[model samples]
Target: MLKIDDLIIDKEFEELLPVLTPEEFVRLEQSILKDGMLDPIKVWEEPGTGRNIIIDGHNRYRILKKNNISLNYWENYKFMYADELPTRDDVKRWMLEQQLGRRNLSEAEKYEMVQKFKSVFEQKAKKNQSLGGKGSTNLPKVDTRKEMAKATGVSEGTYRKMDVVMKSDNEDLKQKLREKKVSVDAAYKEVKSTDQKPITVKQQIDRLDKRINDIDKTIESLQVEKEEIIQRRTSIFYALDIKCPVKYRWDKKGYSNTFPCFWKCQIYIENEEYENIFGEYSVYYNEFPSDCDMEKIPETYRNDFRMIWKKAHDEIKALQDEVDKKSMENAKKQDEILKNAMKLIPTDEDKVILKQFYRVLANTYHPDNKKTGNAEMMKHLNDLKAVWGI
Candidate 1:
C-alpha cells in the first residue's frame, strides 16, 4: 500500500519548463506501461519524520500512480538513510546542473533553466547570509550571463536575449520561438514594440502626417511614464521574523579546548511556509558569543541579511530600469519608421484604411530595416503583414 505522503516532489525542481514534449511524454508513458518500472525511483528519508522524499524518477512514479499500478516499495525503489540526506538546495541544484550538463537543451529551455537556477542561487545566497556574517552576498559583481552561458554551453548574447524572452511573458510567442516561427532577435524587438503606449483616439484620428510627427513626442511621454513605473515598483522581500532568544548547545573539542560556534535561523520566505521549497539555512557564525542568546542577532549577520534582502529589492528596480530604457530606445526606432512611412502614404482612401495601417506597421517592424533592422522581429512583422496582404 503506497501512501501519498510516502514521497513529495520538489516543486522548485519540477516547475521548470518541461524537458519532455507531448510526443516524448507519450513515448515515455508507453515504454513504462510495457516495461513495468525497470528503473528504481530514488528517494530520501527525512530525519525524525520517517517520511520518504522522492529525489528522482518523478515522471515514472507519477505515470505508474496515475495508471493505478502498484509495486513493492523496497524491491522497486531506492532510499537514502537519514544520516545521508542532501539539503533541498543540494538536490535541486545538482539535478538541474546534471540536466544542463548532460542534455542538449534548446536555447529556449536553456534560458528557462538559467532563470530557475538564478532564483535557486538567490535563495542559497540569502540562506548563507542568514547563517554567517550580516553584510555578505554570494554573487560577485560580474557578467552573470557570460558565466551562466558558459556553464550552459551557449554564447552570452544568446542567453541574454533568451532572458529577454522569459521577461516577455507571452507563451504563444515563446511557442513560436520554439517552433522556429520567430528568431531571438525578433522576439526581443517584439517585446519592445508591445510596450508602445496607446495614443488618445482624437490624436489617432488627427491628420495622418501630423500623427506621425507626434509619435516622437508620444514616445517621450512614454519614456517619462516608464521611469515613473520603474521608480514606483521597487519591491521588497519578507525578512525572517526572529523567535527571540534562540537557544543553542555547543562543544569544546580542541587540543587547547577552544569553543567554536555558528548561527542558524528558522525563516519562512514571504511570510509563507517554505518547507516544501527548502529547509532553514545554517552557516558558521564566527562572531557568536559562546553563551549567547540570539535576541538581537549579531550585527555582522544582520548586515549580511540586509545586504542580501536589499540587493534583491534593488535588483528588481534595476531590472525595471533596464527594461524601460530598452523600451525607450526601441520606441525611437518604431516612431521614426512611422514618420518615414507617413511621407509615402498617398492622401487617398488607402491612407486611412485599417489594412494600410497594418501595412505600414508591418514595414516598420520588418527585420530588414537599414536603421532598425532586427532579423528577430520577422515573426511578429509577418503577422502584421499578413493582415494587410503585404
Candidate 2:
C-alpha cells in the first residue's frame, strides 16, 4: 500500500538510520532556516508492517525531530510509492555521483561510497542482465529519488511549496512551472505579478563580483595616497639640523700623528690704544676648494675666527642632511628603475651579483666607526666625508 502523508516512522526505524555529525546537523539546520527543504523525504509502506519507511532524508527527519517541529506541518506533504521511487542501489549510485561533483567530500569517503554504490549496482545489474534480456531489464532498478529531487533544483525545501504551485489548475501557470525549475517563490510571484519574468543566477553572481572589484579599487587608491603623504613628511629631514656625527675609516692602517692641515706663525704688536694679533697659514691636502689652514685666512677675518669656524660647521651639517635625504629619495626611485630594467636585462643573475658588489663597496665606505675593524685604519676618513654622496 504505497501512500503519501499517511505513514509514520517508528522506534525501530531509528536504529537503522544513517549517522550524522554535529557539524553536518548544524549546517542542515541553518539551510532549513534559510532555504527550507528542496527535496521531500522518500517514504514507502513497510511491506506488511504498515509503517512509513524512509528511503532517503533520514538526516532531515532526525533534524526535524531534534528541533521539535510539529508533525502537523507535514500533513499535506506529497509522497511517492516504491514503484514511483528509485531502488536502494540506484539511490546509492546517485549519492556517489553527487559526492563526486562536490569539492568538500573526502577522498576516502568518496572512494568508499563510490565502490559501495557501483559494486551493488553492478552485481544486481549483472544478475538481472543474465536472465532473459527483458526480465533483466525489468529487474528492480535502484532508487534515484534524491537525484530527481536535485534535478528539480528548487532552493532547498521549497520543493514542497513548488509542488503546490506546480499542481495548480491554471494552464499558463502549469506551463511556467514545467519550464526549467527556478526559485519556487519567484515562480509563484511571477504568475501573481503584472510582469511574469524571473531573474537568472548568473546575473546574481555577476552583481556580487562587480561589488567586490569596486571595493578593491577603493582600497588601492587610499593606500597610494597614504604612501604619498609619508614620502612628503620624510622630505622635511633635508632642511633639518639632524646630523648625528659619524666616524669612518680612511685607510686600512691608521691616522698619521699630523693633522691634515698646515700651521701659521703669529705676531702680536701693541702700541697704546692699538693692538693686533694675526697669523698666516698654508693650505694642505684637501678634496674641497676652501679647506686651507690659517696662512690663507685674510687679515680682515682675524678678529672673527671663532665665528668663521662655527658657520663652517653649520654649513657642513646642512650639506650632510641634504646628502642623506637625497640618498633616501634616490633609492626609492631606483628600486622601480631596477625592477623594470631586470625585465629587459638578459643576465639576471649577473645583475644580482653586481648589486651585491656595490652594496659591499657602500659598506666599506660607510661612515660608522664601529663598522670598521679598527680606529687606526680610519686616518683619512674625513677626506672621504666631503664627497660622501658621490
Candidate 3:
C-alpha cells in the first residue's frame, strides 16, 4: 500500500482545490467508512520513480485510505489511460482539462480550476519554447498572464490583488485566501498595509542583526573555501614531493584585549617545514572573521572612524585573492596529472580484460536489478567510462 505522504501530486492540481480541514477530513472519512467510495480514483504510475501519481479523485482517495479501504481496480479505482498519452506531461494536461470541464463546480472552484489550467498551460508553453519548440496548446506568447486572467473571469485589477494574496509568504494569510475567509480586496489591503507600515525600532534592530549574521556567514563560507584551496594545493605538493611553509603576522596597532588584531597571511613555497597542513577548517586554531572582534565601537567616533571596516575588507579581499590564485595553480597541476594519466594507452590484451570487468560491473549496476543495483553507482561508472574514452 502506498503511504499517504508518498502520493505525488501536481502542484498545479493541489493549488486548484483547497485542502480539507481536519474536521472536514474526519467527516469524509466517516462517510466513506459507512457508504464506501462511489467514485473511481484516476491515477497513473510515475515514469522513472514507479510511484503512484493521482490525476483525479484525490479527496475520495484520501478518505478511503483514512478509513482503511483498499482500492482494487474495477472496484474502487481506475487507471486514466489513453493510447495517445505517451508522456506524463500529456496525462497531466488531460487531467487538468477534465477538471476544468466539470459542470458541478462552484463559482470559487471554477475560478480556481481555470487559474490552475492557465498556469499549467503557460508553464508547459515556456518549457516547450526553452526546448526549442512551440507549445501544442496554440496559445500566443504576448500578454499571457493578462489573457489567462481574462479567460478565467478575473478582471485585471482584481487579478493583481489576488495575485499578491496568492504569492504572499505568510501561511495564515494564504490559508485565509484558500478558505475564502477574506475577500481578495480585503487580503490585498491587509497585505499592502502591513507591507507599507514603517518598521518599528525592534524590527529595524532585528534587520540589522540579520544583516550582520548574513555577512558573518559569508565570511565563514570564504574562510572554508580558502581552507579547501589550501588543502588541495597541499595534496598536489605532497604528490610532487614539495612542501610549502605558511606564515602569519598580526598587526599590533589595532590590538585590544576586547577587540581583535588583524593579521596577514603568506605562503613560503621554497622553505622547509615539518608541520602545518591546514586542510578543513577547525574551530580550535582558526581565527575567522566570526572569531574576530564583536565589541561595538564607541558612539563617540562611530561615523567618522571607519578604518576598522576598511581594514577588515582589505584583509578579506587579499586573503581571498591568494586562495583563488593558489586554487588555479593547483587545478593546472591536477590537469597535467590527468593528461599524463590519459597518455597511458591500453594494449589489446588490457582492453580485453577491461571489457570483461566492465560487462560484469554494468550487469550488477543495471537499473533493472533493483535489489543489487544503485542508480548513482551506474551513473558514476558511465561518467568515468566517458572521461577515460572507454
Strongest candidate by lDDT: 3
Point out where model 2 deviates above 4 Å.
1-19, 33-38, 46-50, 72-78, 86-108, 132-390
Q: What TM-score number comes out for model 2?
A: 0.26
lDDT at position 105, candidate 3: 48
Q: Name the better of 1 and 3 by TM-score.
A: 1
Order of candidate numbers by lDDT, starting with the best? 3, 1, 2
Better of 1 and 3 by lDDT: 3
lDDT, candidate 1, 1-390, per-residue tens: 556446777543465435577788788799988887777777766443355767667787788778877756765577766455445446556657766776676677666666655645555555665655655555343454565776556687877777677555467888887666888889878866865866567645554655565465445544643543433331121133542222222222331222122223232222243211112333233222222333333442444443443443344345446666777889999999999988765554643575566666657766667776566676766665554344
Q: TM-score of every model?
A: 0.42, 0.26, 0.38
Cα-based lDDT at residue 340, candidate 3? 89
> Which candidate has the highest TM-score of all?
1
Model 1 ranges with Cα > 4 A deviation: 1-5, 10-13, 17-26, 72-75, 80-85, 101-103, 127-151, 169-172, 180-182, 193-390
Taking all chains together, the TM-score of candidate 1 against the true structure is 0.42
Q: Give one digit per residue, the lDDT tens place, for model 3 in 1-390.
A: 444455566543454455679898887777777887766777766443355667777888767666666666666666654454545447646766676566554334445655545544565556656655444456445455675566556787877777676654445876776677777788788888887877689777776876686576556544643654565554455454443333333443454422232333321223354433322121112333232232332233233223333444465556556766777999999999999887786666776777777778889998999778988989988876665456
Model 3, CA-based lDDT = 0.58
